[model samples]
Target: MALLNDIDGLQKPDNHYILVLYPGAETYESLKNALAPLISDLIILKKRGFNQIGGYYWSVELYFSSDWKFLAICLGMKSANTLHFCPWCDCSKNEMNTTSKKINKSMDNIKVNYHKINGHTKEPLFHMILLHNWMFDELHILLRITDRLWELMLSDLRRENVNEEIWKEKILLEMKQLKISFQFWYKRNSNNLLHTSLMGPDKLKILRELDLTAIFQSRT
Candidate 1:
């Protein structure tokens, strides 16, 4: 839903804005209608000689939130949620033999099949990548887990075992500490002032190295 500006070999946010705001259920027809003009605009950019390479127009690179069903529709695929079907790589379980190992795929083969198999697609219109917003995903999960844990501690099964005042103090202190920790991590990990340009893949790489779960577990 946002255009990426290439800055120093990095795709960063420049003038970020919402493209659509609709009420009620969103369907494939609705999405295509909303997206058609943007796609046409990219084609116009090509016509204007804005982003040409090797006598061919470079397709626009689009990163979207991790909505598997929606992404499948965007990619002109029937589905993409199963382990058998990955847009990134080819790895699928054998259809004939249930116990057989997965079949690995070559990049060339995947691209050829992917472009050819879509019922509605004549050719790829853009380069799309799934974007799982780690900041929001982790924050939401962490807060929910914290809330549930607090509830369980105060439930009838364990309420009278510990002093309520002391328990509350401990829980509050831990929550405050986590908040401070997360702030520090955010400030350190972010390169842009607005924090809107954090690359999903780069963040995932950093997370693998840092292993924030271990840190959280240590605190608990």
Candidate 2:
């Protein structure tokens, strides 16, 4: 009990905070740079049960206890299909299957039901997802793109003899297909004292520059 209390003390609540929510598993690193400020504060974090596009991080926002806090969702385009009926594993690949229509129908009913019973008491809620000029069908495409990127990144890390040039090209191509562009930046760190601090390692010398979290695939 004493140990738990000590850990709790480090998390002292700051009143009038902005609540930032995010789930675990594949969702952990999605909103990296865009969420740097809120993540630094460490307001609310939750592991959502089976991600939902509109409310994947809603579970995280709900964990906030502050009454005056404002809820801002990153609401990126690919975030919407995180909960849809798609399989992305080795077992399901190269096999013909259909989406879970029943699950789709059922979840829709729940969303509809929840939308009906709404009231505000403590903190005000806000959505950051861009809904303007968005098509209904593109939601699934966005999710697929995210899933593909996740799979590719993991593969690159684990697979043997991964081609750097080819893999980088693939990542860039994926970003291009999604209509996303990446910006580059450079920084000088104190750790580079010897100008050869961390580069002692062979593999760490090179890496892809794609921003996984900030990747936004505009509609084609």
Best by lDDT: 1
Candidate 1's C-alpha runs over 4 A off are 1-14, 21-24, 51-70, 78-80, 93-173, 179-220
Each model's lDDT: 0.43, 0.32
Compared with the true structure, the alpha-carbon lDDT of candidate 1 equals 0.43
TM-score of 1: 0.37
Off by over 4 Å in 2: 1-100, 103-135, 139-154, 162-220
Residue 210 of model 2 has an lDDT of 46
Tens-digit lDDT string for candidate 2 (11-103): 555423344455543222445544577544433232332356775533332222111111112221122223321211112222326453221
Q: Which ten contiguous residues of candidate 2 have the minimum total lDDT? A: 64-73
C-alpha lDDT (0 to 100) for residue 109 of candidate 1: 42
The alpha-carbon lDDT assigned to residue 193 of candidate 2 equals 14
| Residues 119-190 of candidate 1: C-alpha lDDT, one tens digit per residue | 323222333232221112344344455545434533532335544445444434543553322111135576
